[model samples]
Target: MARYKAPTTRLRRLALQLRQLREETGLSHQQVANETGLVASTLFRLETAKTKPQLRTLRTLCDLYRTSPERREELEALLRAASEETWLQPTAEYLPGPYAAYIGFEREASALHNFEPSFVPGLLQTEAYARAVIAGSAPKASPEEVDGRVAARLKRQELLTQQEPLTLDAVIDEAVLHRLVGGKAAMRTQVEYLREASRRPNIRLQVIPYETGAHPGMHGSFAILRFEEAQDVVYIESSTNDLFLESQEDIGRYSLMFTDLQELALGPEATDALLAKVLEED
Candidate 1:
């Protein structure tokens, strides 16, 4: 249940198309900038999807590259899409660009496999737990902003109970259970929620113990989302940056890694028992 922002999606697609056309033409970023009268930094931004290009700028790039009429029309369509507002526009203010893209991906995904080594995944977090986690991570955020984000996250959980629920397979590191993210009471409730969520038919919760020494996901946490109409994407998030990998090779590698991690984690019955033991200790 990631937060949504509308504008970034269109911008991202346009950027990707621009980069692809440049690559096909074998033009360097500086070369494209020089020929199109656009700044090198701007070209770079468009290619890497850091910013949205104006309509005129997009037309200029297409003209410089001698793109076909059909292709130009397609790019314009992308631009138009970028200009449209999304349903989650109210929550767009606080969300960063990459996160906005993640929300878009999450909304379209048919199934999601998430592995979290640190905090609990957002889709499963209770309101109080989510508030504490966000506040701790973003200390400068106003209370109202935190509440908005919490509300957004809670709204995302509706996908779980929808008529067409997204299949969620979550692999959590055992350490997350003991981290005490939101104080004793909040953590207690969170752990209890995890136990309750595990009861759902569409959700599969597994725990990778500390003893699973040197597993493939030891480097970082990632999620591989599978969509019905689109290709699978692997999302990797860090403290300050996030990456979305759509290339088949990269997605395949992460999928393999997820499978391996799933193999090493405790089975459902054993995982439930372990969770119960932790709750008792708490």
Candidate 2:
């Protein structure tokens, strides 16, 4: 069955604003439900952006919160915007839960701080590198499914080449370069692409050598996405439930971790040299 999730930029903003309004009133979900005759669960879904908010419902809640006209109009606009196509469109409805949301956020982000201990970051991955990573990890997926996924991923790489490209600061583990995902030849190609991509003004790539033992990033990979207009978000990929951490505290921890990794990792010049060496050895 096809999922019906729309692009979530405007939806996400509405979610945050709705939660903020509710918090300002200091009313429990149950209290608001009772006053408005709305179900508590429905309110939860609305605040979390799980459901497309009905206009009547939004109006009722706005009344309950005693929102000023200006603030209410802002929210109404977001609701209207949610129904429109967003940048990238979040078109792959079959993308796993929260995965589409992450892509949607990435599309609108101004800058990204990424730490990848396993493979290259999606934004930096070449088509072949992405194909190897996808196919190797999900051997059971049909060739058609793999092809579709590979295409979707490559589409994301466009963000890096766009006129106003997303600024990417990525710290990749040294071992990632050595992994011959598609074969020795394919890995070499991927490394060469990385060397070229690193020189782009929008991308800042670094490599952490094997000598950096048991670092903060050893446990897992995560990304901190910063927006020009909104608060920062920390994304942690998981086998089961991928997480989007929006709290200031969570953002702080991940930001500091990336800073530490950046300091420990080689500079761009060193990274270029290291990739050159890997290509020679391969």
Candidate 3:
């Protein structure tokens, strides 16, 4: 089944700030709820990001929290950004859970660090490569659904080419290049696409050779997204489940893992050469 996704970063940030401010004021959730004429559960859901806070709610919380004008402006700005129409929001019902949130974060991220031990990272995937991956992963999906997914994924690639693009640092395993996702021809095309994408100034691509064997990335594929004003987030992707980690400790572990992978992986020059070689063999 395609996962259901809702953009969560803006909402999450606003919620966290509200909770923090309330705590700083030494007001319990119930106290704030009573003062604001909101149910405790409603306030709890807002803070936990289970519900999006309305503008009225935001103003109320801000007033109760005694925020300075500058702080209040920042919080309101965050609310606006969160409430804005994200590319994926219209299709959130069709996306996988947490998947939409990840894309939402991707849209606003200043930089992205990706470690892929499987197929190519989605941001770097070509249309054909994405179709192959999506088809193989969801054999039972309807043709229309498949087309929708493929379209959404290709649209996601716009982030790479947008004016003022995000910096993408990707570490792809050697096995990923070796694996034939589409047919041999399609795989070759995907490799060539990767080669070209790697040449872009905003993208830094590396390949970890097979000889490295059983590395830290064996645990699974994960992405660390860094934002301008929002907190850093780590996304862990597995076959059956996906997790979003925001705690500093979780971010640290993934950040260090990417660093180690970068150290162990081939340099850009060698990575280019390796892709060229793989293409030749293909």
Task: Write candidate 3's Cα lDDT for 1-282 as tens digits.
Answer: 553545657777888888889989999989998898999999999888888888888888989888999999998898887767767755565577667778878888989999998989999888888999998998987777778878878888898899999999999999999889988988999999999999999999999999888788887799999988678999987768889998999999889999999999999999999999998886
lDDT tens digits by residue: candidate 2, 32-83: 9999999999999988878878888999999999999999999899898787
The C-alpha lDDT values of all candidates are: 0.84, 0.86, 0.87
For model 3, the run of ten residues with the poorest summed lDDT: 1-10
Model 1 stretches astray by more than 4 angstroms: 1-4, 7-84
Q: Which residue ranges in model 2 land beyond 4 Å of their true spot?
A: 4-7, 23-28, 85-94
In TM-score terms, which candidate is top?
3
CA displacement after TM-score superposition, residue 245 of candidate 3 (Å): 0.9
Residue range 104-197, candidate 1, lDDT tens digits: 7787678999998887888999888899989998899998778877877887788789999989999989998999887999899998999999
lDDT of 3 at 32: 90
- In terms of lDDT, model 1 sits at 0.84
